[model samples]
Target: MQICGGGRYDNLIGLFSEDKGKDVQNKNVPAVGFAYGFDRVIEALKMQNLSPEFENRKILITFVSDEFKDYCVKVVKELRERNITADLDITDRKVRKAMEYANNKYKYVIIVGKKEVEENKVTLRDMESGEQKFLGVEEIKFE
Candidate 1:
């Protein structure tokens, strides 16, 4: 019969303790916490027809030069490992033309260039929403 379950903090003991230094004793000692059942939330949303069916849309990872081709391959491999639909510009088009092709073909674009490779980062741009984010090379994990 678990109607609800959550965590709480009991700071009364810490608040009343006097043996510790006055500076430590005077610290703010309010308790705080939260609880959530994601499964229940999903069920509720489904009942309301508000749950979105996640779709795997294609993304394009464009490389501007032969120098960055290997890095581009690595990024493509990482994206695919995450089950993300992705492709690369094997055509070796110019930067502007590649961007054009990506915009037309994919929902999102991951741009990797010489300077980006040197800086160990990549730029991700959403074609439809026009939003963008720059991610550090190491920060991106496939899984």
Candidate 2:
């Protein structure tokens, strides 16, 4: 979410030779500059109504027990660091409710529990296909 633009401005210094009504000076030089405005891009995204089919893949990390909360957060962080869109369930909700939310809003869900954490693995579920599989962090894949 950034835009940068710059161009050469030859003979532009003469225009600024007189500053604050001070004594005018005779000089000239080329100038170039660039600026990035993320706020404007964010505003445009909010205003635009894109098709649902164009949405990016979303992953939800759900915990099987409170004991694995830290591990769940770590997994989410790792995914995000890899530029993967991921979220975590921190509301202390039941598995059924969490799965429902993930199925509705996320494309995939990674179930983290004691066993998975102990084995340094996670249960990856494909929401659309209702298919599930166990995979190590290094074995994880995305669409």
Candidate 3:
């Protein structure tokens, strides 16, 4: 096990007054320190088959019709450029199937349709809460 510990000793400088041959500090000095032996902790957790959960924001850009496909693709590209974990269907899947797939894997779903494309906005849906709202592309904080 990678057992480790650490501390600071400010007054410890004064204990070294006998400098052997060279002149050194004989007064207390301010100090601080810390150490991490998390390798051991991680090893123990691994032995128990324990794992940490990671939360990732997932967004799927879905379109209702083929006409909106181009717009959805554009929006998806923009989101990805902003470092968002966003994707869209390239197989021209039906809206129902697209939504089902999104709900299974994504935390958010952005629906692009004729109206949304014309309005330059999208219907952002929260998969977990089933709540949705219209949002401008600039308003989406994927980063």
Candidate 4:
């Protein structure tokens, strides 16, 4: 029941072997690699009750259009700088679809639309309480 395996490979070594760029063949440097059976390991963890709990501190930023992409990215960067787990939805999905995707995974959702862009504000929605408010990007507070 090996959940993971690793050792060494001697033939795999080079500066750029795929020849995509310059194939500068270097000496065989000692390297080791390992891989895990991710699905099996997760199942074992669940059975043993060793899986970690969700933190629920992550927030999702969804935009109405590409027009607000820059603003949304800036907001995300600010949140990350403050040590908050923030992610931007770049899938070009509709606002409703984005909300559905963030439904159970994120604690809050920051919606950036035309109004928010023009006003330098965002609509922050609490997923748990179903409460929302329009706030300036700098005014968004996190727990």
Winner by lDDT: 4
- Higher-ranked by TM-score: 2 or 4: 4
Candidate 3, residue 7: lDDT: 80
lDDT of 2 by residue, 2-117 (tens): 45567788767777675625543445566787776666654556667542332345788888789999998888888878767788989988778999977677888889888899
- Quote model 2's TM-score: 0.62
| lDDT against the true structure, each candidate | 0.71, 0.77, 0.77, 0.83
> Model 4 reaches what TM-score against the true structure?
0.68
Q: Backbone clash tally for model 2?
A: 0
Candidate 1 pairs with clashing backbones? none
- Which numbered prediction scores highest in TM-score against the true structure? 4
Q: Write the per-residue lDDT of candidate 4 for residues 27-141, one digit (tens) a residue.
A: 4467899999987786777677775432455889999999899999999998888767799999979999999998888989999999998888899999889899999867876
TM-score for each prediction? Answer: 0.54, 0.62, 0.59, 0.68
Consecutive 10-residue window with the lowest summed lDDT within model 4:
19-28
Clashes within 3 Å, all models in order: 0, 0, 0, 0
lDDT of 1 at 58: 70
* Candidate 3 structure, TM-score to reference: 0.59
